[model samples]
Target chain A: MIEAIGVSKRYGETVVVDGVTLRLPRGGVTAIIGPNGAGKSSLLSMIARLLPMSAGQVRVDGLDVARTPGAVLAKRLSILRQDNHLPARLTVRDLVAFGRYPHSGGRPTREDAAHVERALRYLALEGLAERFLDELSGGQRQRAFVAMVLAQDTDYVLLDEPLNSLDMQHAVAMMRLVRRAAEELGKTVVLVLHDLNFASCHADHIVAMRDGRVLMQGSPAAIMTPEAIAAIYDVEATVHEIGGRLIAAYFA
Target chain B: MTAARDPRLVLAVLGALALGSAALFMTWGVNGAWGFALPFRAAKLATMLLVAHAVAVSTVLFQTATGNRILTPAVMGFDQLYVLVQTVLVFALGASAFAGLDRRLLFAGEVAAMIAFSFLLHAALFGGARRSLHLLVLGGVVLGVLFRSLAGFLQRIIDPNEFAFLQDRFFASFNSPHHGLLAIAAAMALAASLLGWRALRRWDVLSLGREVSITLGLDHRREVTRILVMVAMLVSVSTALVGPVTFLGLLVANLAHAVMPSFRHAHLLPAAFLLAVICLAGGQAVLEHGFGFDTSLRVIIDFLGGILFIALLVRGKVR
Candidate 1:
């Protein structure tokens, strides 16, 4: 389980994430959906210890995320932010192999290689394994980055805006991959999502945020209501139940 | 990308290039007395080779740590300050009086100042907020220009003979190189390279930038601090040896990146070292023998290196 106790991120008097207390249980996809500048990314980064919180604490499993050694915490959790630009030109296979660095400490053994291969396969990036990251399309690059994170093979995977720059088809495929990672691998997956309908359709738990504070947190049925969507996004969104899933129609 | 472009193959080619340069530098033309000329030439050769290694390795490692290919230590006003130190020395004591000072004291004082300058620059610019690398580069370039103007201003006040003497010492001509400091510099550079080897192991993670490095459990702050300290030491060693060749670092480090198949420092560092050796030794040999000592080695490196720097900028690679 990931626990955040009054986590706050302040940058010189401008509070981005303000005293947000929450618990994200393990083994399910928790989609943090909010408008831009709503502190979704900030909140996710705080939980993963990517950014130092101005106050409060976060713990992954029973270990304090802030206090644990990075290598030890790395085995428990991994994070992939939206922009994964690299100065060095790296092939998909080479980039994925870096995920094993925390475990093997730069010298990957046979078992590490197997994990890398599995990650490549998981993302359906096997064909593009030899291709450099810069040469790939944005969507493919997104998948390749996710492949690297998956290759980390941690108990918890935190993704910040993982669906950015992804087209509809690729977005659906990526979400399915995230869901599969949760169900099959039993990994705890938390992600910042842009599209509310995707969260409504795919996320088991939804946490809505606006103005650096959590508006609500519950199952999709409870958090996907029309008023909840409006309060979170400041846009009139109609909620519809289709095929036993709450889908938000906000594009109109 | 190609089987023919295997890293081992590139390593062999670069190794060959280094060896070829060393051989030519050692035995280009031996008309003078064997005992006197050979050892004298060997000191210069050794100095050039050590500076080459120091510049290349320091730049590559510094770039790796900062995740910016364009920000060589020299670009960050490392060598500019060295020049400023020499200029101020000459300006204060006059060339004749400055020459009377102990060379080792002068060298030690200059190295100490450069080390102090590096730490101050890093602490001031890199603290409080995590400044972007481009901001750091901009700050460095601005400081570099400031130092150059200050040095130029000092040079203008000095006497004509003193100005010429200072120019002779500062422009990085292979002729009249500092022979006495070769052993000290070479040892310092060697110790630095050995210390840097540990940091190089985790460079792959460090190369990924701050978040990923931290995510992988690598202490990004500690590693960058270590690498920057190493850079300060290496830059001091090289500049104390042969004046500063700012563009030389960019040339060799970028070449190593372009030549290597991976970012593994194990390969990049060696490749960069060989390229640096080849550039310095070969440039020295060509100047000594091919051009009959007509021009300064620094002149050639600066001209070509400046153009290459502009090319890298135009290509949108530096940012």
Candidate 2:
């Protein structure tokens, strides 16, 4: 389990993530949904130790993230940010292979190769594994990045805005892959999502944040009420039961 | 598999060409005094090779660390710092007093000052604030301008004869290296090269960017700091050896990247070093023989290297 206690981040005079305390369970999909400048990405970054928190502590599996060695924490947890621009020319397979760095330290063993292949196969990227990441389409590149995180095989996977450039079909497919990873691989998946319907349909738990603090967090059934949606998003969202899923409709 | 073809054979051929060039450099003046002429030219040859290797390796590593092709150790105000140190020495103690100073002591002083400056700059800029790399580059440019202006101010105040001596020291001059500084520079370069080789594997991961490197379990801050220190030391040695050759490193590092066509630093580093040596040695040979010794080899290299740098910038090959 990943736990954040009184975690806060301040940039100069402004507080970006203010006093966020939450516990992400061991195995399931948890979605953090919020508006722009809601500090969702900042919270995720602090949890991953990508951005240092100004106050409070974060622990992963009882190991203090700030105090623990990076290598040890990296084996247990991995994170993928929204924008990843690399200067080197790398193929999809090569990028995926880097996921084993914490284990093999860049010298790949036979088992590492097997893991890479499995990740590529899981993402349906086996055919495009050898192609350069720059040559692939936007959706394909997004899948390749997901494959890399899956190849890491960490217990806790944190993805910040993973659906940024993805189309609807690919976004659904990506969420399904995340759900599968949680269900089959028994991994804890936390993602920052924008679309309420997708979060309602896919996530086991939904966390709503407004301004650097959690507005509400519970099952989709509990947090999908019209009053709660309006309170968090400041828009009248009519909650309706569609295909046994509580979907939020706010457009028009 | 074909893409992964080992560059060892190509490296061997380049090594052979270097050796052949060295042999020619040695025998080109064989009929002169054996003791004085041969050893003097040999000292020049050794200094050239060492400086070339040092600059090439440090520039490539710097580019990898910064994730930009155009920025080099020079861009970080390293060469500017060297000039500042020289100008300060001359201004404080007068040219004659500075001339009387021990060459080894002077070299050590220059290297120590540069290392300290680099550490201070990195720590100050990247320590607290979450500033971007571009900000750091901007700071470096500002510092470079400040150092150059201060050095120029000191230059203007010095006596005419002293100014002449200082001017000679400013421009790169391989033909007249202080032989006493050669051994110390070689040792420093060798130690840095060893450290760089040990970290070669991590360098490939670092080139992927910060988030990936962190996710891969490499401590990004620690690795970048260590690489920066090594780069500073290497640049100091090369600049102290033959003065500053600003664009040679840029020219060679980019050429190596273009020729190697791979992201792996294991092959790229050696290729860069060899390319540097070949360029320096061959350029010197042609300047001495083909050009009838009419001009300094530094002029030729700077001319070509400057053109290549401008071309790279115009073509947007920097990032």
Per-residue lDDT over B93-165 for candidate 2, one digit per residue giving the tens place of the 0 to 100 score = 8889888998768777877788788888777865775566557667877888898899999899889888998
Kindly give the stretch of ten consecutive residues in candidate 2 chain A with the minimal lDDT sum.
A83-92
lDDT of 2 by residue, A1-252 (tens): 889999999988998889999988888999999889999999999999888999999999999989989999889999999988665457889999989899988999999999999999999998988787767888898898889998889999999988999998999899999999999999899999999888999999999998899888999998899999888889998989988999989998
Candidate achieving the largest lDDT: 1
Model 2: lDDT of residue B194: 78
What TM-score does chain A of model 2 get?
A: 0.98
For B170-267, candidate 1 gives per-residue lDDT tens digits of 75546766776777777777777777666666887899888888888898878888787778778877876777787999999999999998778888
Models 1 onward score TM values of: 0.93, 0.92
Collision pairs in model 2:
none
Model 1 ranges with Cα > 4 A deviation = B1-4, B85-112, B128-135, B151-172
| Model 1 root-mean-square deviation | 2.7
TM-score, B chain alone, candidates in order: 0.87, 0.86
Across all models, the iRMS values in order are: 1.5, 2.4
The reply for model 2, stretches above 4 Å from the true place, is B1-6, B9-38, B90-105, B124-138, B158-172
True contacts kept of each: 0.66, 0.66
What TM-score results for chain B when candidate 1 is compared with the true chain B?
0.87
Report the number of the highest-TM-score candidate: 1
